[model samples]
Target chain A: MIRQANAVDFWRGLALVMIFVNHIPGNYYGRFTHASYSISDSADLFVFLAGWALRHLVGTPERQPPTWYLVLRLGGRAVTLYAAQIMITMIALAMLASVAILRDNPLLLEWHNAAAVFHDPIPTHVGLAAITHQLGYFDILPLYVVLMVMAPGIAIVDRFAPNLLLPLSLLIYGITLAVPISIPTWPVDGQWFFNPLAWQLVFVLGFVMARPTGIGGVVRQHIVPIRIVALPILIGFVFVMRYGWWPDPTWFPQPRLFFLFDKTFVTPPRVIQFLALVAVISVAYPTIQRYGPRLVDFLSMLGRNSLYVFCVGSVLSLAGQILRYLYRGDIVIDTVVVIFGIAMMAVTAWLPEWRERVKGRPAPKLAPSS
Target chain B: MPAPFSRDCQVGSTATASESPLPNVAAALRDKRKLKILAIGASPSAGRRSARGGHTGETKDILQQAIRGLDVEMINRGVSGELAAQAAIRIRNEVALHEPELVLWQVGTNDALIYVPLGELEQTIVETLRWLKERKVDVVLVGLQYVDRMAQDDHYRLVRELIRKIAAQENVIAVRRYEAQRLLAQAADSGGGLVPDEFQRSETGYVCLSQYLARAITLGVFGGNLRPRELQNLPPRPQN
Candidate 1:
């Protein structure tokens, strides 16, 4: 089993809390979230950590798990995410419906892309299950489902040809940007909010790096130099974004697809920025764990049960939105919502750990170790 | 809920509604029973609920019901903090993708808040209006939402006048939301405060704005001083 309270859990748990606050469209706390200052926000953290967690959850390349069992395990996680997404969507629609009916205002039905669910449920439910249609602020899980489903393949590649995985993933990502392709949404007709094709690169990087050998190993060996390069990029992006000054797109020559800062493609700047952040943070995580506040343990507990916590956080944030709308967003309202939401998430995390504790099982991990 | 109509604050409420700015929208409605309307820009049209609970969708639903026997499909792509300059560039792609018959843009608030370059904001609006005209897409400019305190804010007043000037120069129907909202405050009980409480969106205010917008559309489409039928059965806010 994995270490119960570590930096991975700490960071992931923090990301969940941030994601919850950020999901609320106009919450007062939004300005304080990482998105305000950084190009890549908690979403990047969540995805990257998911990749990092995959290594710990499953086996590394040296002692790979049985192929069939590994496939089944990854498949199960995917199915769970798929179901969680569908459930949250249905519940969010129900929440919107209750508000609309209770207030006698049909307009709430149209907000947040919930119109499809209300106007036509059967086909839209199909779209929701198929992961083709997603509501605003309720997207990332589908990407999680996709990444988990693809994890076995990544693990397999990491086992057989570790070098091929990143190259292949990058090749696909690069091709998508050059071709301007993405997974499309349904009923509404737009691209998926979190395009998986490009995002899988980060996921693969997380998986490969967690291995003792590979790009991650290289980085661990030369982290000082990597941090030296990364530190400047982070400071530069922070300055540029803070000043509302972005590099002009026209300055790039032809085939500038790779250079653009567009979010959909997970372009160079965002990826590089994220990588730089990771390089610096990874170097400092051990020291942080040694001298961190008591809050770190509290957050790590939430991180240990991330899936359940994330699902609960998503629904709570929606409720927070409704509460914000009804009561009006003041400092008090926002603070109360965030505290209550985090508490709810913490409770959700505790229940699972408590359940497994009473049962005397080794804290029900994601997959059974062979 | 037949709220008293405010003739004084109604900007384009007169007959003709300024040469039927959304001709193609009406034409499309008449020809095929379908019309696509794109709602863009900030706060109001983005279908956001204010502290008072006013919804942009109230306007869409009211227009559909008032026009009677027509399907109005609305695509709301409202990013709350989007500057007019950013929206101007983005709208080109939105138009290319959706090809909406009419575009209802609610802007100025974010620009006012951000203190964007006044000349840049104006140029963007002028260029966007010209582009829409060339594309034969009708547009209605939903100006800055009114907050009583905003009247004293220099940038807010300038943006409001700039929007008014743009609407006149381009000959488009500018829904004077601020004026109507101020009228709403005036029409409310005096103890309720003479402002629309900018923090919360009011359902009554949403209804009022929707009704006014529907009336403006009806006037534009049929060139008559008509109003949406009284939707009498609406629920009031429960006492907290």
Candidate 2:
């Protein structure tokens, strides 16, 4: 039976909300709320849950579908998502260009130029750079696609020959560390905004743990102990960082050993921090599952259709910007407009559920227990 | 060891100092009150060399010896190849550590070489100087010398004017090294048969130039107690 964990859905929904809240300018509540968690930490947990949900949806062992069928299904979703990304980029570029021309400002004109835009505002540059080559933060979509395509090959090894996944993942992770892999930053900049080669290890680890095997069973059983150890370790790491234990390399030459744990490029310390966060979440999962009500259900609904929600949310954000441009006065008014935009997105996200409920089809059980 | 000089050796007459092996040059140069002077900047003040040989002059030692007997301790805290922005980043740690009474800032050269936009460079320098001034650290901003072969064009002039404007607006002492170099070249021309061509053209040109400028800056900061002969006779530049 294809089942989803309500707990996972609730958390994923919460993360999506946090992501949206963080994206809005002047909205610091989300950051403060998740101050204990790094974005990568939340992202790692979300990707892991994604793998777990995939396993549940497709079934494991006895009820497993054929490898080819699984590949086709995952690959199709990836392609569809990638195509959607391209369409969004084209639209965004057109909007930016139109805005620049309408403003008739030299600075805005310079911003439209790829080289100048890349130098001045990197985020927008990365989005535009995606058109020619994958050079934006959205490179994550392509990376996810690659992983999905390789998941079948991984699934085969995972099912019959589970022991191979660890050594192979470790090898890939080691290579990722040893090799200096960087994606180009665009028109003028050469450095990668985010290096996927290093980041892929997190996804691979998620994939390896997703299988209903010995490691997963161990994780399920030892949740409390993992949390007990992880919480202190994470706290200590944060304390060390805050106190400036790592010497500024400009003042003194830093040793190569320190680079092993440097998180500027998703180093091992980041990986440890991510795992620690997951351990805490796993311990809290059961509680969230029990107490989560309508409010949690709303978020889980948003999480279930995250890609669709993100696309709609992005367009709503554009609308919010347009409104602000027209009525630029009170901070209270701006905040209200942002809230209205979020509400609009929320309504759009729940439309399908409302339709299904009207048809008396039990709302298709959006939250599943794995 | 015996006191370097006897209390009686404080005689005004030079005749009293002929017998001492190490005459009281320090006593002669010492003012009653010590002035807390802090010398800082990029590599030029740090007394380090860059890859381009543009910063070959060891101005630090010249400034050090020029103020040696004066009631001032000149601290050199220059890092090699640092732009103004990098200097701004480290100012809190570096300049604040010294608690300097007076800061000699010689930067902006590397920023030009590294192709940092002039606007950013100006902002960084202005903010850094403002930060120091707010902290009550008196600043003496040294303009870049036109030594880089690549910077020999009109671009160097533009950079020099930018530094001048920053110095003026901040109400800091502007040490015009480019003007000083031009004056030195003019002095060499005017000295005709007295100053040898070798002193102006040979590798010693930078040594003499730095020593001369250091003496001028020292005299400007303190009074005329520093002697030109004393600065010229200091140890030779260390060769690798």
All candidates: DockQ: 0.07, 0.02
Give the Å error, residue A145, model 2. 2.6
Q: Which segments of candidate 1 are over 4 A away from where they belong?
A: A248-257, A361-370, B1-240
Give the Cα-based TM-score of candidate 1 against the true structure: 0.68
lDDT tens per residue, model 2, A1-370 = 2124366666766666555554433332434546334424445555566666666645767798877787788778777777766765555445544653454311111111221232234444453445323322233455555556666766777767878766776676666555544454333223332345555566666665666567777876777888899998777767754554544323432222124343224666667877887777566656655785666667677777666676666555544443433343236645676577567667876786666557844555567677
Interface RMSD of each: 10.3, 16.7
**Under CAPRI classification, how is model 1 graded?**
incorrect
In model 2, the Cα lDDT at residue A301 comes to 77
Q: Count the backbone clashes (under 3 Å) in each candidate.
A: 12, 4
TM-score of chain B of each: 0.78, 0.59
